[model samples]
Target: MINAFGALRPDQPIHVFTKASRWLLDRTITVPVTIVEQAVDSGAIQRDSLQLDVPATLASAAQFEAGADEAAVALAREFRARHVQVAVCDAPPMPCTAAHLAGVPAVVLANFTWDWIFEDFIAEHPAFAELPARLGVRYARADAAWRLPMHGGFGTVRTVLDFPWIARRSRRGRAELRRLIGAGDARPLVLISFGGYGVANMALAHHAGAPYRLVLSGGAEHSPTDAPPDALHLDRERLDALGLRYEDLVAAVDVVASKPGYGIVSECVANGAALLYTDRGRFREYPVMVDEMPQVLPCRHIANASLASDRWDEEVAGLLAQPRPEIRPLVNGADVAAGMISAML
Candidate 1:
């Protein structure tokens, strides 16, 4: 979205506001601010820490909603102060509400929204029962919403082009990347990534019994200490220093093993790599992503419990045996979004 906007209007200012506060909700969300910080440091986008306000993790649903509402106020204050004309948001309704409060156009672009995610947990966690409705009210404030394929079915926004894939499209050939990563050519190298925060209770050593080389990205925080010595660990800092984004590594590898998040799934398919994914508990987007991604890529799923056991051996073998499917990349949604934002501007 940022790149597309820049392409359309190079002189326009683009500032990314990401939530930052200590939060213990999901380890998966724990490092989002850090990731954004890195992106800002990389000079990809300008950042204003003042607009980023979120509660600490472990806040109850009521507390979460209240915090988001409070954050919206701060976001509005920042927008007014900065004279922001349009708010292009990927997060929930907080940013959108801020845009509304500032009487500016709120353009939401994403595959999933917060209401759909909260819906799944509402039944079990009563604190979240009222959250869906609250989020719905705030989401309705967006002036425009541009959606992507295999979404959570929450937002009724017009479907835009396919979400842009940010990975480096061209990568070192398999043989070269394999040699650089110290993996033998006989076995395929699988890049394992579960976003920034690693999945809990997963043992990469389980794949040690398989014929492939397992490269775990950002897994040191959650991986068991007994993880296999042969398993490779690549933190984000090292990835940045090498001038390699995760998708570049993904493109070089034979298979990408990850959770069914939109960013990773879209990048894997766009890069023409096969997918070996697992569940992210009851995350609302997973079911849709799992159903849709297999249409374009050779996709296989492994059970959460089986992740710590030898069950991945058969699945990996089967995925490797399948022919690599041809990937026809879709038109990027960023351009469509940029066009829309341009009209509003």
Candidate 2:
């Protein structure tokens, strides 16, 4: 969403409201962001820990609901003080409700809503039965929604407008990124990314004799304690010193091996890199992304067991061998969304 925000009219004043997390603060977003501590938690599923912690998720939801009124009051105060005309959110229920409460026109940009996502968890914990409906009410308060592709059914939001993929493209060239990462053109470079919270017990030494060079970002926190010779762990500081962004590494890679998430999938598409994906548990968005990704780029699926056991060479080979799609989707959704937001202003 920050990438789309960057594309908005240069003269338009935009303020981003988000939780203060290392994952968000580390990125270079050219916009004024207002960090609202403890506004909400989406209870994101950890790829390494596939087991859904129903109790924890439910508790997080309750906490979010408990602070909604207070958060809304603060947001309303800010909106009035700034003379904000329109509020934009990447499909957060609280922001929509808060914007409505503040009497600010809210535009939601997302492929799926939390109401649709939480619906998948009701069977695991019956307490989650009411969450979907409750969140649906908040989502309906939004003035409009800009739905992206590869999305679930958003039954709550009243006014919906379909939009293209809003993905960040690489700013640097492939050769430059490879040189920065110390990866030569002789071997294939594969990026191992599992989002902000990386997988648990990831043994990078398992890829000791692998055919490709492995790269990991955000330091040794995610790297194997005994990493193999071929593995290159790029810390945040190293990346910053080299002037390379995450998207640049994605563009330089031959393939991305991980669970299929919207951010990674869109980046791979924009950079022309193949994807070797594994199952991301039972999240509703997983199936939709897995189904839709193959149409735009070369993609292959590997079981979680195969991924964990270091048996990913076959899938990686398949992904690399697969030809690129003759017709690719437009990678300029951020600009398109910016144009719409400009008109709205």
Candidate 3:
């Protein structure tokens, strides 16, 4: 999983880039990590076979150029000097450089939950188009590029790997919530956030008679300040791939109304829930950027708010009225990923 929100600085609170990257790393096999984020250098950490985070002893902080090629090269050299094998890297700051310089292949991919139902969106994105030369420098797998036409430009397909499917961990904090409206009767529950923009969506939730849960993830720059009902509190936990936050909720919620950011949508699709979006546009936090964005969600691409759009609300209501669908294990992007990584190694 490669995170970019720390670089793009989106308006919402969620860190899509880091979330996606960690999710992939979680489902896959053991791979040492040296995270190079803009303005910070998180020391190296060892991973487990199941990709779970065990206690990691940190080294002295090293200098890394923010989003610079030199930083990547420096890290690679450090790895070589220490005789350490660098398995994977997140976007920018040298995963590509490490692959190019070290002769290891880089599998560039967006996290699974983010890209699920949006019309093979990888082809519509910019990173896929821009990273090829860097990729071709040695061996590389543009993870979802071939499947998602939006991620690439006109080019021949190379390796195909599935990035990990990261479900949300919203349910963990559910018990902590106090109570906003003391049971406003019965209404649909919607989770809303413009991804670290700090937009307070309680009004929308209130209007729709739905309770919304806001997730403040990662070490974001500006945390969400506005408050919703105490019943709806903050969930500030780091959820790796094994977490069942999304799996549990998707099995329970009416509709997953969110901005068409990749991870959330992918989770909705895998969970078998209908999706509704307030609108559509560019999200710097989005790991994969696509031009023909509408095609991203083959299931539902909503322009107006679910509360505002009659057809969308009708659709949502229809979904809620039916018996809840059983949530099942979704696509194993990491296994596809493991195959790609193994081929490269």
Q: Candidate 3's error at 26, in angstroms?
A: 12
Q: What value of lDDT does candidate 3 attain over all alpha carbons?
A: 0.38
lDDT of 1 at 246: 65
- Comparing 1 and 3 on lDDT, the stronger one: 1
**Candidate 1 weakest lDDT stretch, 10 residues:** 38-47
- Candidate 1, lDDT over the whole model: 0.62
Model 1 regions lying over 4 Å from their true place:
20-61, 67-70, 155-176, 199-201, 205-209, 222-224, 323-331
lDDT of 3 by residue, 131-241 (tens): 334324322333223232223321322555434453333333322221221223345554443443334332233332223333333233333334334333233343233
- Candidates' lDDT values, in order? 0.62, 0.76, 0.38
Which segments of model 2 are wrong by more than 4 Å? 1-8, 32-38, 45-52
lDDT for each residue of candidate 1 in 196-288, tens digit (9 for 90 to 100):
445445444444556777776664575454556677676666665665556667777778877776777777776767788766654566677
Clashes of each: 2, 0, 38
Model 3 segments more than 4 A misplaced: 1-69, 82-94, 111-187, 201-231, 237-251, 282-315, 318-330, 339-345
lDDT digits (tens) for residues 31-78 of candidate 2: 655544544446553425344555676768866766776777777788
Worst 10 residues of 3 by lDDT: 49-58
Best-matching candidate per TM-score:
2
RMSD (Å) per prediction: 7.3, 2.3, 12.4
Task: Give residue 3's error in model 1 in angstroms.
Answer: 3.4
